[model samples]
Target: MENKKAIKLIDKILENLDATGINTDALIDDIKELRTYALEQQVPLVVKVLRLTYEHIEANQSFLIPILEDENDEELAEAQEVESTPVESLKYLIALTRNLNNKMNISDLREYKELLMAY
Candidate 1:
């Protein structure tokens, strides 16, 4: 059950990537790091997922995260969050992918490791 859900998350990311053509590099690094942490700390499966995801988000801070104060208009800021650069988006995706590889029941990790080279 947990494996299914974890795979679903990866699928979700891949789908989003296909639609948006986003890159995924920095996110992969975060994911891999979080997996190590999860195993060492004995975190629960669900918590591990969330933690890894959060770390992925955190790893691409400049990209995934926006500078709210830079918004020119308050209404626009309030109504819609700005999207990051395409490169930034890809980095975020990579981070998430690596996290998935570490925490999920994945068999071929080397391929994932190789794919996480660019953002």
Candidate 2:
């Protein structure tokens, strides 16, 4: 599949449950929170990559995002803004993912950088 790297990243995330001894549901919930925070922080590149990985997870038959009846439109719009070209977006994603890997002390997210490099 063209999304192989994305799949790999998701697998590693699932694997982290066992590795880190975190509960599965709790981890997913935490990731959802991080996703929301990343959006609010206006890190479009990281948000884009995270969304893609979430899509891969959804495709595997798991629900992630909750259906919110009232989401703040202004906040969402701010998060969607892409102030850079695709190339620049990828660069930012690479740097941010590297930062995430270092902070998490897990090399799993490195796949995201590798996948971006292929583009």
Candidate 3:
């Protein structure tokens, strides 16, 4: 349930990015690349969040190293990073979900992503 909520939250962040004018095409490419990487390594979604979380932390100008730090902190940092995207990063969210590890339902996933990206 928590991971589901977090995923939705990421969708909202992406939406905001779009609204703000981020280069979504590039974001999509990045997500696709990430997904491919995840598949190749058989990594789970939570760990996939590792890259996004790291990106967010660096953007925040924090001095902490992702691999050496806390999980909760990483998740929150990734959530906050979602706020920095241009207008809406909805596409990125879609890409991430499409690459999920089969732990959650797709319908529920879309609903939250839609709701969060609504604004």
Candidate 4:
């Protein structure tokens, strides 16, 4: 049952990626670091799905070009605000993971969640 839910989550992530062209190499690196923490803390399954989703996005770099190119453009800030970025997607995943894993009392996880929220 959990595996089914994980698969559905991945599908939804991919769907959102297709609908919105937003992602970044920095976001992917951050997600990889997050996954490493998840693995060390025994939450491999959840982070693995997230890792796969980001890997898919990494493969589709063309879709991310516009967003990456405009990342520093002050004029694009307002337009970008309305669309979901990779970091925002990761935050939602982190929150969902926190809810799903009742045993998650990791202090680092809590700190990371706060940091992401702050960003």
Candidate 5:
């Protein structure tokens, strides 16, 4: 798939992930579609990150929500926004896709992928 199409798909997936109430079923479908695009583009890092993201959400159904809810608590109000971690990671993936010519972005992508895998 073209880079433009892949970026758009990634944006859509990010939108779904960042929504108020996440729908795991729909999110999984989007991830699978994005993974197919990554595979076609022959980008192994993108493919691996997408795969790990899929498995993480699959195993932890409410992974994003708890952090979000905690962020709403008064005690955590002063804390940095940890809830956006996953969303930020996806945004990095989007950045990586958009700037494939830039070798430096690959490190960010790899780092995010490692974080996801370690989670």
Candidate 6:
């Protein structure tokens, strides 16, 4: 069975990201709480992803833009294709967190981490 607690936490984080105006402090707090939970669960990959995500957002708060619900179809499509961007990488991480199978691709996470480091 999947860990419902983790899924709920991830969903909360995603919802915060989707909000019109993101409160950076709250987001960071949520990420830290999730990372602690992952560590307790002994999920190293999840912990790493959360740590990297926290760092990326902390360093680039001003540059971080939440994906809007009303964005044009073309822009959303473009965002999905441009995985190198930080925002897109974050979105990808959120998607990874929501995987029903509870299997996160390490390679993809590594790639996103590298991309985040580039900025």
lDDT per residue as tens, model 3, 6-81: 4554565455455643444444444455445445556554334534533543454331211111245877667657
Q: At residue 2, what lDDT does model 5 achieve?
A: 62
Residue-level lDDT of model 2, residues 5-98, one tens digit each, is 4334444544554365333364445455555655665655556556664443445333332221113585654554543333233223323443
Cα lDDT computed for each candidate against the true fold:
0.43, 0.43, 0.43, 0.48, 0.65, 0.63
Model 3 lDDT on a 0 to 1 scale:
0.43
Better of 1 and 2 by TM-score: 2
Per TM-score, what order, best first?
6, 5, 4, 2, 3, 1
Q: Give the backbone clash total of model 1.
A: 9
Output the TM-score of candidate 6: 0.66
lDDT of 5 by residue, 53-114 (tens): 67777887634321222334665643525545655445445456566567766776677676
State candidate 5's TM-score: 0.66
lDDT of 5: 0.65
Tell me each candidate's TM-score. 0.27, 0.35, 0.28, 0.40, 0.66, 0.66
Cand. 1 TM to true fold? 0.27
Model 6: colliding residue pairs: none
Pairs that clash in candidate 2:
none
Provide the lowest-lDDT 10-residue window in model 5: 62-71
What's the true lDDT of residue 23 in model 4?
48
State each candidate's clash count: 9, 0, 19, 0, 0, 0
Q: lDDT (0-100) at residue 18 of candidate 6?
A: 67
Q: What is candidate 4's CA lDDT for residue 55?
A: 67
